[model samples]
Target: MSVSLPSALIGPLLVFVLLDGFIQGSVVSLLPVIRDTLHTGTGPAMWITATQFLSAAVSVPVFGRLGDLHGHRRILRVALGTVTVGCLLCALAPTLGVFLAGRVLLGPLSATLPLSVGLVRDRLDTAASRRGVSLLVAALILGATAGTATAGPLASVAGGGRTVLWCLAVLAAVGLVLALTPRISETVRLASGRMDWTGAVLLGLGLTLLLGSAAQGAAHGWHSPPVLAGLLLAPVALGLWVRSSLRSSEPLVDVRAMAGRAIAPAFACGFAAGVVVLGGQGVTVAFLDAVPEEAGYGFGLPQWQIGLWIAVPALISFLTAGASAAVGRRLGYRAMLTAGFLLMAAGFGVEIVGYAVMATWYAGHLLAGVGIGLAVSGLPTVITEGSPRDRAASATAVYYNLKTAGGSIAGAAAAALFSGLLTRSTHQPSLAAYLLLWGACGVLALVSAALIRLTPRT
Candidate 1:
């Protein structure tokens, strides 16, 4: 039960996790620039980021299945190669549609994080693997921060954001090269069968439908035909897939295992965790920019400062992740999750009731970050520990997919909450909308904490 990981194990995990985070964060940071360069409207422009979200949700489970069927290293190579080619396409694309096609190729990176988690579990001793997982989580968050903080400046230096794609391509290339280097060893028994292609298709289509609707629901009226079709069919398709999986001798995911008390709460929290982390981030930042100086709610910070300020919490979150493993071990994973969510609730609560001074804002964010770091670090460990060693990738992928879905739903909720709020001439949300966002985050965090409590003590 030694909780120390060797550099050999930690290095590859960080590389893949960081790549995933960097790609996601950088692509998002580039949307406005892409829109300006392509001369596209917000609706068309959204595909830049939305495509990643949709693809990630669907592809994660498939990658997980692939890992269970094949070796994780094999799948990891494919995923890294996919990202490399995708970034290259993005860099070379002459048109918006072509760029989007390139984005579709990069979707496999979504699966890389969970796959890395499984890789670590396969290679390390139990306690060391747990610590490795924490490092992976930290790299995921920290790399996102690096992407957000650096991409803009890098774009400026390179004369456009397209060069950032080139850099990403390079990173992906390095990763592909590393995948050839034999370091991370596979230890788990591989699940045998033809890959569950039918289940994969169903799951992919269902997620695409649900997330596509959510992404577009803000712009298209909720009652729009496209949105309505997705809303209705998503569940039907998913339900059929579930029924099929239960009957199939070999399923992509073990739906039955998901019902066990030990695993159930982790899945539940997975969804909430995504909503709070991604959605809470959106809400917190939007509030910072939206609160007018005259309104005494904000200090009228510049965009760079605003991003930096927002990172205060994220930075704290990143640092907390490294220590989260040991902390969770001492505190118990359940207690850690409970406290984390409670802290997040407190963070949002401050936003809801307190003044918008700089100190108050940072304090709230820092507290929330601590909570997020603790909960996120704990959830997957629970999943890995509870799942059969052979199905670790599938289990981790399932949790990760729910997290992506939660993020999509939360984004839509934020849009719905702030819809139609035009601040005078500016296109920002009104103060009231920001307040609502904060309150919503607080409530969701509280709910997440309650879910952790529902976990059995076994």
Candidate 2:
């Protein structure tokens, strides 16, 4: 477990992870161009991203469990190959259906991080594992920032969105090649039976229905038939899955492990982070772009300028996350986590109070970025460390899935808030809505800090 790996051994994983983040970020910026090129309506075009999230919701845990059963390296390589093919299909697809198939293939991209974490934890010593996980998190954040910042420019230079997709495909292929190389070591595999297919299917089905419902409800109304049906059936599937898992000797995911002190609290942190940070991103951009005169309060910035504002905080986050492990080492992870949440609360408080001031807003974002970096990077380590050695990836997967669920829930709530509190003339969310959201986020952050503080040390 303490063995040192050659950079070559781990390099491929970093590339795969960074590329995954890049693709996720870049696609959002290029949605407009992609839509026009494919001649798709707004609703269908949006599925390009939604499909991936749905896919990830299912794939993350499945892949994690598979990696635990087989080897992390084996599963990671398979995932890379799948995503590579997905990229190629997307690049060349002539129709929306084909593109979505490709996107479905691309879902495994999100699993790369957890897989890599498991691999490093299995191969590296404790200190090294902590550092490695932190680095991967930083790489992800960095890649996303770079991708989002450059996607528009890259498309302009390349002449078409397809060209950008092609470039992404090529990068994915390179990562796959690296994964195929013999130099990379395989992780320690489980000593037990085959993966529990029934549990996987039930869990996947349940999560898909639940996430799909949230997504559809956010887009269309919550009362839509599909959403209603999904809401009604998701619980049944999930309940059955839970019952089966408890009964099985070797469930796909050991549900019992989830109740442990370290994992449960870490998961709570991830969920809170998703709700307070990840979920509000769209509204943040909207806030930046809203016309001040019409909306009564907004910066009235152009899209490019809004990206810059976002980039500043992201850059800070990248730096902070990269250093978070070392800080945790010095300060103790519990204390670090507590501080992280406090910083986020302070950030949200600043943003809420100084809504009209640009400098104050930027400072608030920076504070929140630092907090997010610490929490995001540290939470995974906590989960992995506390997990059964063989189940590290599975534990991380649960944390991720829960985080995504939180984001979906928050997104739905935000949409409802904006719609219900629309400014009469502009038909935009009232400034009061943003204030209320931030206030809620701030309160939640404070609550999370207390919870982390109260959580029993592993």
Candidate 3:
């Protein structure tokens, strides 16, 4: 398990992950544009993102199974191709509905991270694999920063959001080429059994219902029939999905394995990170973008400048990710996870001060960037610790799926907050919403730190 890979062998894969991260970050940059272009309200704007998370939540696991059943390299190609097509749809769409449909297509590409993790494990020796994974993880995190940073400037210079989408399409196409560049031999893990189609549908529908309720509740009164029904149906649907998973010959998630010590905590951390960090991303931008100059409350920066601001955390995280594995080696994953949460908490606390000093803002974001880098680096290693080599992709899928779902839930909550508070501030989430978000994220980061401590050492 310790073969060193040629840079040529690894470079394309790293570039691909960076592209994925960039695509991920760029989507946030595009959210405000997409919302404005579609003429949707603030509450509805979040659906553009929430829907992606909900859809990706279900699709990631399914792709993981396909990767296991067939091959990681083959499935990755399918993911890259699907993203290229999805980018095409988004770039050309004439209306909000079409754009959302395009967002659904983009969900399948989420499997790339887990799939690539599997590829690294299969193709490299143990020591080399560890280095590759660390590099890949850093690239994924760094690309997001680089993309977010670059996109704001791109938007400022490119003249429009649609052009940004076109840029994304070209990026996806490049990723497709890189995926094709590697003559990697496909590694098939699971050699038998059919897919859990029933499980996938139930899980997807259930999550959609629950997340939909949070979103719809903001637009319609919480007492509205559709919202009410969604609230009532979500748990029942999810419960059934769980039951089906437990009884199925080939469950989408292995209940026993998931319940195991190391894996369970990793999933928990992923979910927490989703709500507190990933989910907060959109709101963070809104806080900077929506606050009017007259309001005298926010930085009053332009959209692209706000993007550069947002990218600060990502840049710091990117720089810190290189050291994450080494830090974990020196201080144990438990310590790394704990430290990450604390840094995030500190960052949130710094933001909550809402001081006029722009430097204060950058400092908070930079702290968070480093914290997030550490957690992202450690969480996956923990999840995959005792997993079978063949099952690595699927196992990682479980973590990613929950993380996506957590982000969806947090976004729904933010949308609801925006709906109620928007009357006070027409452009952005109200000041109240911003305070609540940072406060919640801070508390949750503290909680996550505690939980990581309880994860039994492998």
Candidate 4:
């Protein structure tokens, strides 16, 4: 079927995608500044990042299922509006606790990307849908890159860290406006399933505990009572969620839907990629911050400069993601994933060498950017291709949730590792921490490669 959307609709949708990235990227980009301003250690700062991911991890699947039940466009509008409020709260927050409250509110709103993707699928014909998906994905990557890269400059322009939060609030408001534009249409109005409140609550609690425990374990010691309790509760909650889901007349997560052969592997690849890429990025940022200026290990760049440096890689990733869509059509999804993982592995290896020499680190970051772009872009396609027609949105949501969770795991792990190294050494630990992180990322990439290879060709 040939579908013709008004030209006006495209700009608003595109802006929404970009804004989604801007909010997420801005939050992460603020990590260094927040750490400095709050007088909090790396562990707490890491939790700031982890909280956003954990919240999103808990919300995405639930939101996706809801979107499918109600309407994708309606959900998008509500989410964007809620995000605007959250961003405003963040801007107004006077303390770290208030800021964290804002982040928790914003977390569920992060499902905007998947919801947007589903909207595009619902609105467009096959050809236009494919192109729309590609563009939306590219926008998402660019938004993240731009947020990370430009946040520093913007903060500098605004005159302080607080100004950056104001800037994010403004961007979020713009997104909300775009979301309200009348040109957008409600699509995929599925039969209303009973809202599985019990299952959702159980799953959310389980994931939050599991992720929270993973994040805090590094800081408090794994054996700490709180950490142990969270860990202990995670499995029990998960088992309960599973059991409830299996028995429910209308389940929340739909476990059986996830059992499809192709969908399972696609999610596995995405989750694994999320862990390595996010972890690597966390380590790189931390290394930049902790390294001493006098020691050849540090750039000693200000937050703005570091933020700008991040942009270079982000731009490269955006460009590569846009390119990968076309390439995937020709080479197929498996080939693209394999190639992406290899490039990512190569990037990590280069980063390790650069740290060893303590020279020209930007080149390594650029390589890593390209790898992340390529790998991340291919993930949606893999999930979409494998999913059942009715469950496509939920399946994609599952992938995104896993990806967010993986990133949290990686960030927490990096924090723990770096903290451990610092405790042991009086001198700069940049080289040691980075080397270990790079090696870990390389191993992750290799595992992804192997997984891709084992999967049957589409």
Q: Which regions of candidate 3 deviate over 4 angstroms? A: 1-9, 32-47, 188-192, 279-281, 289-296, 353-357, 418-433
Among the numbered candidates, top TM-score falls to: 2
Alpha-carbon runs more than 4 Å astray in model 2: 1-6, 189-191
Mind giving the per-residue lDDT tens digits that candidate 3 earns over 221-322? 789999999989989999998899899988776767887776777789889988876665556665565545655457677865876687677767776676
Best of the two (1, 2) by lDDT: 2
Instruction: In model 3, state the lDDT of residue 203.
Output: 82
- Deviation of model 1 at 156, angstroms: 1.0
Top-lDDT candidate index: 2
lDDT of all predictions, in order shown?
Answer: 0.83, 0.86, 0.77, 0.75
Q: Give residue 400's error in model 4 in angstroms.
A: 1.0
List pairs with backbone clashes in candidate 1.
none
Spell out the clash pairs found in candidate 2: none
Candidate 4 regions off by >4 Å? 1-10, 31-47, 189-192, 288-305, 357-364, 422-427, 454-456
Clashes of each: 0, 0, 5, 0
Instruction: Kindly report which residue pairs in candidate 4 clash with one another.
Output: none
For model 2, residues 1-458, the per-residue Cα lDDT tens digits are 23344586567767877887898888888898889878899999988988998999889998998998899999999999999999999999999999999999999999999898888888878887888888889989999998998988889888879899998899889989888888778886562667888998999999999988887886888888989999999999999999999999888888887766667778888899889776655578988888888888888999889989899889888898888878888887888889999999999899888889988976887898899889888889988898888888888888888888888788878888888898788787899999999888889999989888766553
If both were scored by lDDT, which would come out higher, candidate 2 or candidate 4?
A: 2
lDDT of 1 by residue, 1-458 (tens): 34657887678869889988888888788788777777778889988888887888788899988887898988998989988999999888888898898889888998887788877777777778778888888889888888988888888888988788889899999988988788867645787776788898899899999999999999888999999999999999899889989988889988998988888988998998898888877765556665475443556667888878877777788888878888877888888888888999998887666645678767777888888888787789889888987788889999999988998999998888777664665655677776777787789889888887888652
Model 4, TM vs. native: 0.89
